[model samples]
Target: MSWLTIARWDARAVLRDRWFISVAGAFGSLVIAAALVALGSVDVLGVSAFGRVAATLIHLGMLFIPLIGLTVGAVWIAGERESGSLVLLLSQPVERRTVFSAKYLGVAWGMTGAVAVGFGAAGLLLALRAGTDRIPAFLWLVVLSSLLALAMLATGFLISAGSPSRSRALGTALLVWLALVIVSDLGILGTAMILRLPAWAVLVLGSLNPVSAFRLAAIVGITGSADLTGPVGLYAADRLGFAGLLGALVLILAAWTGGAYLLGRKRFLEAVEG
Candidate 1:
């Protein structure tokens, strides 16, 4: 079968999976709750009501989107291998690269759609209560959040491909998620505090993780809150400018996704052949 066919098959499976369904449902609920909280807290501040909501969503997205993406992707290939389905698929005429590419596309699209739906609900709420001035920022948040999910999916897929079993893959994925989402930020904060890291060092540390990059981009781009980021955000804004910093974030995400895909593809091929 062609890659498109494989992608469709994978997407269908994801849609039918109850785990994904539950996650999507919960995420939508959370998004709606965030919207209500933002609306309730709106005041005559320097920032617009919509900006505050967008900021809230950005923080939520930075944490939860990657988690969902990684969870969805962690068992993708390794689960198939564990079930002996990978062998059957390999026995078919489909090329290995095509399979990997299609699976990646399917997972990425599924996660992206989930993020869009969740965030779209929040956006509609903002538009109804606060007007459309922040619509552009909301759109940016959706796009960036989707990209972050895709980046995390790629990372999880790489772990899945390299793992020997589905359970191991899932474990590794969780560890990777913890490292990127929690440990990395804590380490950076501690290093900056203890070592008196320079602004450039802090900026570099923040840029190292895809999730951190997403947060930096969202705070700087959507909320225009450079001070909230402390040294790293100011350094980036001063040196790269807003547009340049955005470009850099895009590049960083691209590297994470592309690099992970390449590594995963190599490992998958090796696993199949060996």
Candidate 2:
């Protein structure tokens, strides 16, 4: 019951699941379709218009990554718990944290591989059709955007591992995502309407949401737009520098995964012994 063994088992399970394959195919196609369509409208990916392309790719990443990650990772722990397999698996000599961490890492590896394939394919298509100007930005879109997807997946697994029931876990994950998408704007709009908040305050609220943070970060990565890369939104790489941003994302993601695993471990103990 080593960590490597646990990861191997999780990876094999995910690969055997039919749904994972379908999800990968569907998401990859959607991204490629959107990027190609955007390319058609603009026809050029010059430095002058890099911002625009970057913005489009950012929007695509924001939309697709969360949707895919949330759905795929929502059932990771809950599904096993549902069938009593989680407890059985945990009954072995392995530590609960090891099992939890290994599963999280294993699922992440599968997701990363699938996304890389799909995005890489899309990049190739864009390259072949759009010529040289768009290549660099397009490639960046593929790589950086995948990072966002991975983060969302980590969050989803956190929710799944924390909740007792599969339905509750997935519901929580979806609600969290919805809140991230709409609550920020709604809160700002409500404050603006009710309290007559200052424009600056409302703007700040909009930028603080993680969804907005990731979106802005992706956009900044793609566009390098000085104006768009305002102080708001957590860029994939924060202003602190590339190493800093990577460290930040990794820490944040690790916190979420760790939190989820701890929660799941507690739940597993309660369910079996209670």
User: What is candidate 2's CA lDDT for residue 202?
Assistant: 51
Query: What is each predicted model's overall lDDT from 0 to 1?
Result: 0.83, 0.65
TM-score of every candidate relative to the true structure = 0.94, 0.76
| CA deviation > 4 Å runs, candidate 2 | 40-54, 132-136, 192-208, 229-274
Q: Which whole-number lDDT from 0 to 100 does residue 67 have in model 2?
A: 67
**Candidate 2 per-residue lDDT over residues 1-274, each given as its tens digit:** 4888888878777777676777667777776676566566545543444344456556666666676677667778888888789878888998776777788778777777777787777667666655567677666666655566666777777677656777887788778777766676677678778987765565456545545656554554555543464443333234546555434534444454455456655654455556
Count of backbone clashes, every candidate in sequence: 0, 2
After superposition on all C-alphas, the RMSD of every candidate to the true structure, in Å, is: 1.8, 4.3
Of candidate 2, the 10-residue stretch with the lowest lDDT total is 229-238
Quick one: how many clashes does candidate 1 have? 0
In model 1, residue pairs whose N, Cα or C atoms come closer than 3 Å (at least 3 residues apart or on different chains), thus clashing, are: none
